[model samples]
Target: MTTLELHGLRVRRGGRDVVHGIDLTVNEGEVTALLGANGAGKSSTVLGVAGLERDTAGSVTVDGTPIRGLAPNRVRRAGVATMQEGHRVFGDISVADNLRIAALLLPSPARSGAVEEVLALFPELETLADRPAGSLSGGQQQMLALATALAARPRFLVIDEMSLGLAPLVVARLVPALRQVAESGVGVLLIEQFTQVALELATRVTVLAQGLVTLEAPASELRAHPERLTAAYRLTA
Candidate 1:
């Protein structure tokens, strides 16, 4: 099984440390939620793990293979795909084209199959295949963004703030898709501010407060003891 681990991970920006030595782990067939307040360094941690932040100091290993300090593209090639906040789909492109662009990293012969596979996962996308991505509803656009990443067929997925600015109904619709992905044996690292949503999706939860891990517990534990999240959520709230 593929596993991602971050050991003593520290991130500094503008000469100040934002993430202070946090450790996290995600295993295949599980979803790990990363929770924190605003400016708590959640973004920094995930980006650092994805190799998007070059100044990061620590170790990021995938199945015991060191990946820290490697380029973001290289990390993706090594089986990690990240979906940043804002559902980053190309506004001017058609849904099909957006998925095709994500598959560019794959061999030519496999690109078509990749697109087909992702579209199958997001059946709503099949109906909007020819529509401009910008014309889709917010939920649909988010779906397109997720589809783009799925088209890459990564072993590990890192998603930051997936429910941001989305309606409850929209977010509700997307949750099942994510659960299906996790059930398919992909290690998922999810950074989310919404405690309820994160707890519902994650098997394990790690909370960061003021750049430090304040709590790391199983989702069931946090669910049973909701007060445990009050401090972290207050900082973010």
Candidate 2:
């Protein structure tokens, strides 16, 4: 049940290859964490799935269909929604309105249903529906970002950094939602900085070193064998 597949996925920016021959697969009902340092080509590889990187060379398939040159909107319509880093929501827009935009990318009937579903699932959002998105706290902003993506009813939920600039409590709050998303049959591709938190939630962990996959295994094994993973990546322990 692989919702998204990338084989030898390559992307270049500013005439330099940021991602080199990366292979990734995201399956339904599981959480896959892409663990890497700042320049490990994590963002480039994920953007290739979204069709945001134009200099992409290689293959990307969503539900077994090729999408190497497809537009981002077309990619979304094919049941993949990406929650980008930094939680970039419309600053002055109402929280509900922000969610509506994500749903508007779909068919009319699906649109309303998607909105209602997410609003009900994220009760915190319902209370702040009318508030400007910019006014929310950092934790609320991250929740709004995830809620907006969930409104798409996407088969694959591509999350980049579920916990980045938040307090410990906020990070704790997001873990359950991510688990619930996977339980509901949506594949999760998560990029996380916190190794312990990522290992706790991820079924699999893919490690990147110098823009290549240096190590990949189940999270359970990686958690139990940190020294092996670190040695594989040659990282500062």
Each prediction's Cα lDDT score?
0.89, 0.86
- List the lowest-lDDT window of 10 residues for candidate 1: 228-237
For model 2, where is the 10-residue window of minimal lDDT? 228-237
**Which TM-score value belongs to model 2?**
0.95
Per-residue accuracy of model 2 over 77-182 as CA lDDT, tens digit each: 8888888889789979999899999889778888988999888778898999999999999999999999988888889988888889999999998898889989
- Top lDDT hit: 1
Off by over 4 Å in 1: 232-237
Model 1, range 9-72, lDDT digits (tens) per residue? 9988888888888898999889999997787888988788888887788889999999988999
Clashes of each: 0, 0
Residue 155 in model 2: lDDT: 90
Clashes of 1: 0
**Clashing pairs for predicted structure model 2, backbone only:** none
